[model samples]
Target chain A: MSHNTFPHADHDPRAVRLAARDGTLVGPTAGLAKGFVQVNLVILPEAQANGFLRFCQSNPKPCPLLAVSEPGERGCAALADDLDIARDVPAYCLYRDGRLDQTVHDVSDVWRDDLVTFALGCSFTFEHALIQDGLPVRHIDEGRNVPMYRTSVPLVPAGGFAGHLVVSMRPYRASDAIRAIQITTRFPQTHGAPVHLGDPALIGITDLHSPDYGDAVSMGDDELPVFWACGVTPQQVLMDAGIAFAITHSPGHMLITDIPDSRVALL
Target chain B: MSHNTFPHADHDPRAVRLAARDGTLVGPTAGLAKGFVQVNLVILPEAQANGFLRFCQSNPKPCPLLAVSEPGERGCAALADDLDIARDVPAYCLYRDGRLDQTVHDVSDVWRDDLVTFALGCSFTFEHALIQDGLPVRHIDEGRNVPMYRTSVPLVPAGGFAGHLVVSMRPYRASDAIRAIQITTRFPQTHGAPVHLGDPALIGITDLHSPDYGDAVSMGDDELPVFWACGVTPQQVLMDAGIAFAITHSPGHMLITDIPDSRVALL
Candidate 1:
């Protein structure tokens, strides 16, 4: 299911966590833990935790749940033995009254006993699988960010987190697109599979080059644009919900964990 | 690996053989027996048998081999019991020097000890699978033939049998195309997944409406044409090779075998 193997695909989640905690790794977490999982971090008050959990359950593709910490808890033993959610991520985004407040390197100063942590699966795992299978991921090949767009496809409603879906795009020839579907289907905890492909208009995207988020990758002739659910959907949901105070990992900055990428594969 | 579940999918290969032998079924074998495998029949003299077998082995996508009879033997118990290659199929086409010699209901009148039987898997099983999964097969819904095209993608050469790949096309929306690919990949014996999709000109087909064989189906604006390696490729190969004497099942007149379609699924 998950073709997670890569050259020197070995990393110590504990070491990376320690580095983040010591304030030495304050940049993007990419290439830090190759075979381990990196997740999107979301911190909200215990009052809104149940609703957010339901939101993830209702829309698994975009918000595939890796782990959710208990109210005031800092560590999820299922992901790592000594994980600290507030200090483990490279960077955090503080949103006050549904508006961007400030980006910070550490959350220890603002940490609250009522804060709940959520770790949502990201596309880096499936992207690794696709690469192992020799499928060309256009954005990666072009040395740019994956093109992400807000789609009109509505998510199954959840308490206080209702919104449309966001998708990450990759262009491939017809046959490779098919193989990518099979490969991604095995990883249900990581956005399972694609929600749409080919025509962008059918999914309400008016322009391919004008992506709502991430850099737009060029499409070669005859290549079909395949789309997968993105973790950014949860961020969109949070903004739409107008939460009083919430925190999330800055884009490209993630929480590195001990969970092997292969552990999430269903098959 | 096989997903061989079907309610009342039981069918005796011997009974279908008996019916065809008695002329009780003189037309196409479509829907005569459900959940069982049906095969394209090919009969050639021992002199040409080796080359034909090699051809199928070389071009697995187009000519996936199911079973081959020993010289002077018509029974392949692996597929069915009491099978008669000369009379089992509903119809047969005898080719002479690459030309259509004659169409016959039964070849028992001209049966010879040197003639060898070769059975290849048909697409009926995969079509059944796709329909079971609720993917629309355009041809069946429209009451028309699935469009066929001769692609410039050349097949691997084996002995005197060599030619371009022939593909059977079905139009689908992008999401369905991804699902179709996953479904068909599990059935390698049934032409295992599609070879090409999207733009026809990329595969050397000049027009989608003008196919080399079978009737053309209409394509909607958002629908992409997905192509699978067709069973007709071996027939085309035989014609291209200009074999002196060869026999094949007439269109839609397949040999019903007791082997369950799920038996061919690779999971």
Candidate 2:
């Protein structure tokens, strides 16, 4: 895709998704959907969808559900007027019998009649808010993915879905951390507020320099690492549960929606 | 004064202050005026009042000015209809040449023509908010003073007033601390959000067990020490500057205002 042709294109999330849907944009959707809600995509068989939905409801801190599509449907009108779940996302990961089978750009080939699609809220919605409020996002500044860590804090079990809570780490100064907490609290759908702050060891993460996923950003001498529940949690839980026939958005490749980020703010 | 008589007294700030004005109640104004704006009293000679007012404006976090009375004024009608500055408070501290001269139940005896009174918002307003939100204040639970410490963070200088910032400490679990920050942010008059949290040593305090002012409350392993800019800051600055004559409320004996706490919330 020609970057120059898409001036202020990212500001309109639907436009960005349309470009992705047309196979013209095949990059991460971080800055692409500037002011709209981007989501973590999860597709499961109809038999397991009810259990996963209950899991999200019970463990809202880690899995804030934004939208859920009807069984065998590939569109979610609430998120976007024409959001095609099979192709709107930049990339998708396929899993079979609880193991990674292949990574694909679209899932139209293997669309199952009983498959249900769930669109869970992602941290990008709150991060956009934090940046708009003048708080610096270190990962964005470094042009890297937000560091994700699997904490010892276990999620509340629901039927066949159960696993430890996964968190995204962002280093901020004490004042910035306080402001971040307040900013994020407004978006309950986006994993509102922070799960833990200050020491990483408190949540069972041993090292500050190493992250289970994404690149490690610098933690200044005066800064503390603030952790927010990540959407990667469902993926981990699904893998751990050894579920058959599941699909998730590739890391950083979110499913952009028409829902403005401001619409998701509870405040 | 009989304690049983003031049953619904604390529920209404105006009623509580009215009781003090009528000489019917003269004791610690802590528990008596709940959900009301209690204030730190600072009465200075008109010659020094403007400088002190400038001092407060510069160091708002510590000395958030709620209302200021004109020289020789006995009432701040904006705060209350029958509020008498001379006798509305439970107790007053009379200072002479930067030295503690005497403590009086009422300051009507030392009233001066050039005296100007300042009613700065107190943490009691926010404490009520915290408790209402189900966060337990350790000092209030232990029936002790909220531990206060003098920090290396210097207040902005105005005229002849400048000193290290004084902070009141409240320990809470990390989650509760986040909620406390959100709750207090609504009331900017009551010092707004916390100034610093976590390590006391980061702000130059050596020990959490021994505070520079007020009694020390126990901190649990799961708790993080949160600090808010204290109203005692002005008193400390006055003491440090060695002001010739100044009158303030005695510790624990604040000036109960007629303003309701809900009125101070920015939201």
Candidate 3:
């Protein structure tokens, strides 16, 4: 997302959260509170939280954990001040028996005492770094969602959770691809460096134009389709595992946390 | 080169240098003193030394300077305890008006009082790091010299020094290529990260199989040709500029230094 998308967006994470809580700002969170850390939300029942946490730990590239909320608790104090897990996200996805049930603005009405909230690192952090470093992110330039593919590359299975890896693709020329690798390597929390580059078929991605998820962006003949582990992988894994109930932030509608993006950089 | 090529090679840099000085090691210095820094040598008259140094500074990726000796000095104490500019290399190349004059085991006889010695970082250091990290070096595996090419990419000129950039190619699968980039980035003293990968034509290299220097190693269908600025760049630049007199270590016959490879790593 670019500054043009959020010309009057609040610069404070608290303001963004308050807007979400009041049902006043109900759209994608991209470019809002620009320097703050935005995260992917996943809420599961207490019975499945441990297994899901193990899954995230095992597959860090796709599901790098930022913070975990206590069972039945709404406040994630580590992420932000006055944060409410049930209402702070711009939009939420409620799932039932491996299927998406509904997309809602708030989940307070459906909040459960047995639920546990998880915050996973999002690629927005590294994309911001890339743009700042004068690297072009094709999707951002094309005003489309980053194209994502479900690859045959399997994730290390953790108790009751198993699925193929899902990756987000961004096209870059060879030199820029190398620079992107160096820049993203400093942000391990945000997927680190690319998993595969040059060949899509090598990673079991059959078609470049037809992504399994997100909008496909244009690629130049000189560009290579670079793939990184995506946050969507966890939602797919939840569906594959046939979980009874779960909630995730709707695509592009992430949770804006008080943490600065720089704080999450490994370097 | 592999370990078998140096069945009884000395592990100590000092011992390797002693062997070179005693005329017992009159060949390529690969696989000797394995963990130490091996440098490319260049000795020129004092008249052209400053301009040559500026050229190196301007084009660091190609001519990463390790140490420079004062005019007429025959020793560089920073590189090793007893390093001699005229005799430590396994073989020396004497050039007159940029043309090959002779190849000799030592340059002590012709070494002038007005000569200045320049020691440049070589690719061997990072190659060692790559091998230690379990990545394959194709040329080393095939027992062939790393392929070197003259690219259309030009060097930043200094005074009378100007020429196209020279690059060394190593083929690797995409994942291994990413890992090699990371591994090599730590050794800036070496050539650091790759300059380009994927297309040779973009860099004005029309053919990969027919390199201008060194043996052409085999590339697999699964691999991408990763290129790094080569030490031979200065030698090529020197030839293009037509310097009156100069001395360089023969190809693959490097000057072993006391500095450990790990010691040169930035990280």
Best by lDDT: 3
* TM-score: model 2, chain A: 0.96
Off by over 4 Å in 1: A1-10, B1-12
| Residue pair clashes in candidate 3 | none
Candidate 3 per-residue lDDT over residues B131-210, each given as its tens digit: 99999999999999999999999888795799999999999999999999888888887889999999899999999999
Q: Candidate 3: which stretches are off by over 4 Å?
A: A1-10, B1-10
- lDDT of candidate 3 vs native? 0.91
Candidate ordering by lDDT (highest first): 3, 2, 1
- Model 2: colliding residue pairs: B97-B244
Going through the candidates in order, what is chain B's TM-score?
0.94, 0.95, 0.97
How would you encode candidate 1's per-residue C-alpha lDDT over A1-267 as one tens digit per residue?
111222222558788787778776777776677888888888999899889999999999899998888889888887898888888877899999988799998998899999999899988888888898898888888988889999999988887789999999999887788788889998888897798888899999999999999999999898888999999999988988888999999988888888888999877
DockQ of each: 0.53, 0.60, 0.76
Q: How high is each candidate's TM-score?
A: 0.93, 0.94, 0.96
- For residues B1-267, could you state the per-residue lDDT of candidate 2 as single tens digits? 564465644357667666767777666777776666788889999999999999999988899999899999988886778678888776788888888888887788789889999988888889988888899999999989999999999889997899899999999887788899999999889899999888788898999999999999998887889999998899989988898999999887887766778899987
| Global fold similarity of model 1 (TM-score) | 0.93
CA-lDDT, candidates in order: 0.86, 0.86, 0.91
- Top-scoring candidate (TM-score): 3
